[model samples]
Target: MPDAPLTDLQMKQAAERFGTPLYAYSAAELDAALSRVQAAFGDARIWYAMKANPNLTLLRRMQSAGVGFECVSLGELARAVKVEADGDHLLVNGPAKSDEEYRLGGDLGATFIVDRLGEVALLPPASRVLVRVNPGLSVSTHDHLATGAAHSKFGVRPDQLPDVLAALRSGGHTLRGLHLHVGSAIRDAGDFAAAFARVAELHTLTGPLEVLDVGGGWGLGADLHGIAARAKEAAASFGAVLWVEPGRYLVAQAGVLLTRVMGHKQTGRDFTLLDAGMTELLRPMLYGAAHPVQALWEGEATTSDLAGPACESGDLLGHDVTLPAGAVRGDLLALLEAGAYGAAMSSTYLTRPRPAEVLWDGTQWVTMRRRETAEDIWAAEV
Candidate 1:
């Protein structure tokens, strides 16, 4: 699915099988991502961030593989528990967790990564906690995704650790270890290594750390093997076992949002309308991301920009892109690099439904997540 690797015949087949505007994934690719991330971090524990791709099938695969779960909200918590992941391996992160969510996490025996002092102090006694430290280290990703700096509302500031931990300890909070995530899509492994050094210093300063999780963002290089190797080196000095939370690095390469050209029109410059809109995939409009588009069945590919079928002027999958030259009406197009945030963030805006999702199992395609329909939108209606 990465780079829209879905072939013309395959795209057409998928559209025919599951219907158009399908958000399909490759099971082989997803498994490969799991294998790569596991290989990168070495033998340490890995809690696949279920928020990345929470499709029941994906969760089932991760659960069966003995991976843990990382939840940011109560809903995510429920999703993990539904799969019956081992309680010991469940980790709850993110700031601003509701009181009920905290209670649920504690009752579920999932490790809670404490972000704020207020919640830490208010937490019930004997709470299992991992202090999420805002090292003031910058992840250098999009501001929306950066979460480790002091400005970030993510975790407790470094200066506040002493007082925060004192309260938790006094409250009988079970101190586990220190956790820090500089940011998302981290391009530099050295930055990660340096961040670990800072975390180690914290552990030494605080006492002994039982666990250390360097929240994973993608590494600098795009090469999967290189990415894994980099992650292994970054946590080399930490005495405690290391854990990583990778979402995009694990799923981005393995998925694509398959769309079809419903209508083609020429603007003063040139514009083509796609059946897939921002409602389905918003990375381009939201973050100006690069989702390499490919044409299946269309011979050599032509130089044509593919814009998502959204009314917004900024709704575009790619601009002035090149696929097969002969690609015309009904030609299936593949939007690569959609696996991470595609279906997870989709909406039913503009009255357009999201695509169905299928997983390629090497032998054949399996329906991992069924397509959404009109009934899906109103399923919760009174």
Candidate 2:
């Protein structure tokens, strides 16, 4: 992953000024990342997977850049609408379709990546839709992140493609395209090549296609150059426009999670306790993901376990984390590659209020989301 864009001093300043367990992103970094992908893909249409980060400030920035959004739920579409991203520029995608979601999908005229045959009926007649085909292939990634496997609950099985196509045609829905999203955080180019190749083969069975949404999950360390080439090839092979929904890759390295070492302990194993926990960022506990970590002050390298204040023992963020020898109480540690799923997936589990989120616009830190108070957490509770 790229180095944390925030400087050590800047991270420390944010921690001191805003408090620990904060998420700070760089607007400049986000722009640069978007520009890089746009330049690399050249003409392939790009859409921001709003599931990664739905902060209105970031969404407005994406909208200003002329990028579309791919929403997985009604709430995500609502968030995009709040940023003035509506019409054809938005896409509604997910496995299960709710009545309200289908209603909104048609009301907004947003493209739909239909995962099931039943969804075709749920959509408004003649509404634009793309069938998400399960390629019966799996990318070499974490199981929870894989979506294109034959048994995955994400898409329509390839064997059922013809039936789905016929269903779309008979139902009067506009079959705008086909989509295949194998998995998330794919590090190997071969995986993408295989998935795209399968989609291309399936294209032969379908009628004239206008869009090919090779769904996104490109990781921070994947081969973008090769992926870009494959995207071009897929677009050419299908004689249609290509759209990509890159989520983590575009924003993961642009933000950092700042947490302070509250204390140290040596129960069973050496542990450095921090104010942050699975509630602040769940990827560690959920997916066993490891983000690069470093302390503001440098010292001799010492391996230690890093954990959060959550009651669950599985709330550990990193096992055998190496940090500065003198890293002790009150030292700020910046967890890198947290821009994507960090605050976006945070929750009020254990009634722990969510942390604050800010963006650095080069001049200074601007608060995008304030820390949640107990009332903010309980307001919706009956």
Candidate 3:
């Protein structure tokens, strides 16, 4: 992987303007990623998985890019609608839905993704749904991110699946088709084909099932060969209208977490501390996933640990990470490939303020979200 170096002025300017622990992105980077998705799907409806990062700015940006949304909550549905999501295209996929939220999503024209017999009866009239099925399969990814397992809480198990077809046949619900979210960060083509084969076997439909939503978890900036090949094969195998929802793969490589070095310390071993932590970026602790991390400088660089200021010993960004050896306090460090969940997971834990966010448009950088202040925390408490 090519080291993403920062221009001398850009680093200095970002540190000067946005402060440390800031999250930065490139409009061009995101645009290119989305463009690739458009090219790959080629008419497949891609709904931005809002649960990945629901910042209004990110949602609005995706909306403007001709993408719809996959929402799971009342707030997300409202946000998607507020941002002018096409009424016919909004997708709702969640286990629990308050009766009010159910009506709201149905009334707003969002397509419901059903996982329970209870939902079939509770869903409002005229509501359309796609049966979410568990193919008794698994995809190779982090254990925490694997949602296709039989024990997973996300989808319908094969035993319970007959109940779904029975409900669709007996109940007055409009069952559109099937919805399957198998895994996240999938990397192997054969693995994908195997998963597709299992899900494709469900196409022996006997009713009004027309559209098949193969939820997306394609790995981005890592390897497209696996998913690209499987996608081509799946298109041929299913022979039905297909839809995919890709978030991290579409935006991860397009982002950078621009945090400044807070201080350096040497205990049992050498360490570099930053104002960031698990609060700012939680993937490491949450999934033990490694994000490509690097320090950007005007000249040379070295590998170092980017430690978060959080009290826990587990609060590390990247271990044995490459950074500038000469880097010191206030030096700008760009944690590359952080576009998806970086800023969205940040919190006011220990009263440490979360940082601002910016978007680089290649020609210029624009401040998308201002840094959180002390009172921003206090105001929420009251």
Candidate 4:
């Protein structure tokens, strides 16, 4: 069964044990999500984009499930390596590639996703690589999140493919695959079909492609079956392996942000103030993303605005959300579907300490990451 929000008892226990404004993940949820994806995209390689949630325990769970690591930075690679992730299953991908990153990827025997000529130059001679192609196809997602548009800075432009491929050969890097990432939060199957159709045509650029990296932008309501079929059909046409890097789909619903209602007020509008804000979960402020929120107590339903302790007005967590009527101070509330980009995109804005992260393994909860401290935040400056 798909994972559901934590029970009121579990939420209360976690807050009492770890403190409020905490990130609580479910190991059972992770396992169930992995199984769903594995069953959905049978025979296709699934690489977990650790940028979503790189908690050590999450990484270990993914690794144990035979999921590969899709890393974009040296730090993520280091974490994967620490967990003894299989080197061959790893893929190094990012828009910018530093010399050190290239060297580290090569040393780890991971395939590089070459996005530009400079990245191609950085690869060792005859290294296996996939060139990220920007086919200028726009999906229904946000403009900033859409990467396949002509003006996007993410992938190699289609016009530059010839020169890029030539440069790749000149630099001694063998192009074994093609890649495209249209955007995130995509749910339309037609969008993926459009991208996959473009990928099929790009396969002509390389002789006998080994992998077709269709890219990942799947969200909660995405058409998984339709997308999987499109990819399978394309891979069958080229007889190449299909690879998908899912960052949010497999893990977003596996966690929640538990925050307490510090107090309530009526300022022309009902307000529930929370101790957490964009400082702890930035998706609402960053992308206007909405997550389901509920209260622990039972009361008349009331429409209330949820705001954080941050000074910015945009620190609003939710607008006109329904909470238990008369919910007051110390009421526990949960932000659902927060596992993906929640804590991963947090900041130390206002110098607010980040929340602790805990994992529930069906029977008990374990600390995955300790709460940040004031000294830890200022350590870099000192």
Candidate 5:
């Protein structure tokens, strides 16, 4: 397992300077993660799934590192454009794409990931296309993360690929290749092997293609070499170049959510109240994600549920978390592996201001985004 990106003293410094409910990322860790993927994928094109952490600063870093951007919405496309990413470096993907998204993606000359047959007609004329294939294989992950499952509303079913391809070609669009993305946070290599095997079977129909995008969903601890080997074989079978879009795998372990302990209580379950909760980090309440927590102070160990300041009971961060018995108000707690979706999914619920973000570049702290103010939240309202 990888260590937390920020050091104890660094986290403490950030918390003190930026206030609690903050996000701090390590630049060194981000580079290391990108290097690992490049080393494993070797010649395969790497497109950073911007949804993981779409901060403009991070996006610029990725673009400078020669990583492409995989965008799912118009806003993401705009972000990619803001980074000055050309069509070659941008891949527009989504199950339900809006007209504006299509127009802008088309104008940018991005290769679109067609999810269904109907999308073939909706795409920009002569647009570059990669047909998303739904392998329909069960994967080892949260049900919500299993995008390629038989009934998930993500990709075209295996049986529907031929029709999709035919539609694209007849519509005068360029068919770049086939795309297979089983799910996110997948821990099992066999799940990938099976999905690749399923995709490999489509070679008889697809013939030789230009690119085969085996989408990324490797768990934080997943074996990249093993998964890359299978992905290589699948692309080889199709006689196409390999591409990967890694979202969380590259950024998740590089970020820490810094929140302060606000209070403690005991009602059947001992509770450690935090300044940050679902509004700041919703994975725990939404996907039941369990991030490792580390306390800065030292004392006797005690187990308690980490609760947030929300009025709802489901806003808990962790259950039965072990922390210092001497912890008190203003104490700091670091939530590890929060670099990916933590700030990207943050909301201004309860009209609370969102947290600020900083990046540790090994030399000094750089503020990436300022904390939202109460006035900023409703500034656009009439």
Candidate 6:
């Protein structure tokens, strides 16, 4: 199967049928990505981090594949519950979980990943928990994506693990294991190696544990087998089962953002504007993420920055994008590697209706979510 789900023809068809600023996914790609992870990990428990792409259809797809969920918020937990996820298949994770999150997660019997020492006292009685460990290692990704750094607010310091463990014991909560996620879109194998080594040093403190969740930050083209080997070795030190929480790695390549070339302008930089922008996909602005752009029409190639309709001057989707010079208004463009965090982070900024989402199931298209209406946007407002 192709790495991307929709073909050029299919993307045009989707744009024509559904309208621009649409999100399209491929069912086969999602399954294939999952299979790749399962093959590399070999018996490791896989938890789909729904924060990457939490569409209900995708959640159901993950559920059918026997993949559990790693949720960080109440909405994600609710999504898991909607899919009939059992307690054994749920992991509640966040740095600052709220009371309602703890209550619902506890009611579901989900394994909560405790982000700090103070959170130990807040968990439900006898809650199963994993202590998130910050390895304090610099990684080779965007600074904003680096969560395992020493100053990051994500995990407890290694020195504090003992205190966290003691608190868990005092609170009568079950300590399932340790969790370590360095960062996202990481390209270096050495980063994972170093993190695994750092976490392994804590074996003397943790003893033999139930699980060692070396959280997933595998870049799109990362070496999974190599990373899994390191993870397995780390877990072996503690005699713990390996569990992975993969969000972007499983879904990033399977989806595309279909937007139309609405108009063009030149302001120091050649700008090809689209109907979508920071509100539709924030990674470009938030983290300087670069998604490949494919133009449907043909002509002499020209380099241009892809801009969105958002009023903010920073609402650019891509920079120095190469497209056919003949590409005109109404022509479609597919932003590749957008399957993860694209739609999940979209908003109604500027009152732009959040785009519709569709899935190509090999032979036909299925509407996963309808386009939002102006009324739908204000329905919840007073």
What lDDT score is found at residue 260 in candidate 3?
76
Candidate scoring better on lDDT of 2 and 6:
6
Sort by TM-score, best first: what order? 5, 6, 2, 4, 3, 1
Model 4, range 195-277, lDDT digits (tens) per residue? 88877776566657788888788877776877889988877767789888988988888889999988888888888999888
- For lDDT, candidate 4 versus 5, the one ahead is 5
User: For candidate 1, lDDT tens digit of each residue in 10-56?
Assistant: 66777778877888777777787778777656776777776767777
- lDDT, each prediction: 0.74, 0.86, 0.75, 0.84, 0.93, 0.92
List runs of model 1 lying over 4 Å from the truth.
1-8, 219-238, 297-302
In candidate 2, where is summed lDDT lowest over 10 consecutive residues? Answer: 1-10
Tens digits of per-residue lDDT, candidate 2, 156-250, equal 88788888889888988888888878998887779999888878887678856898888788877777778888977877787888888898878
Off by over 4 Å in 3: 5-8, 205-208, 222-229, 232-239, 298-303
Better of 2 and 5 by TM-score: 5
TM-scores for candidates 1 onward, in order? 0.91, 0.98, 0.92, 0.96, 0.99, 0.98
Summing lDDT over every window of 10 consecutive residues in candidate 4, give the lowest-scoring window: 1-10
Top lDDT hit: 5
For candidate 1, give the lDDT of residue 373. Answer: 75
On residues 1-382, what C-alpha lDDT tens digit does candidate 6 reach at each position? 1234678888888888999799999988898899999999999999999999999999999889899999999999999889899999999999889999999999999999999888888999999989999999999999999999987989988898888999999889999999999999997989999999999999999899999999998998888999999999999999999999999999999999998989999989999989889989999999999887778778887899999998899999989988889667888888899999999999998888999999999999999999999999999999
lDDT for model 3, on a 0 to 1 scale?
0.75
Tens digits of lDDT, candidate 3, 336-373: 76777777777888887887888776777788888888
For model 5, residues 1-382, the per-residue Cα lDDT tens digits are 2257888899988988999899999999999999999999999999999999999999999999899999999999999988899999999999999999999999999999999999888999899999999988899999999998998999999788888988887999999999989999998889999999899999999899999999999998888999999999999998999999999999998999999989999999999999999999999988889999988888988999999998999999999988889788999999999998899999999998999999999899999999999999999999
What lDDT is reached at residue 382 by model 6?
100
Error of 1 at 347 (Å): 0.5
Candidate 6: lDDT over CA atoms?
A: 0.92
User: Residue 261 in model 4: shift from native, Å?
Assistant: 0.4
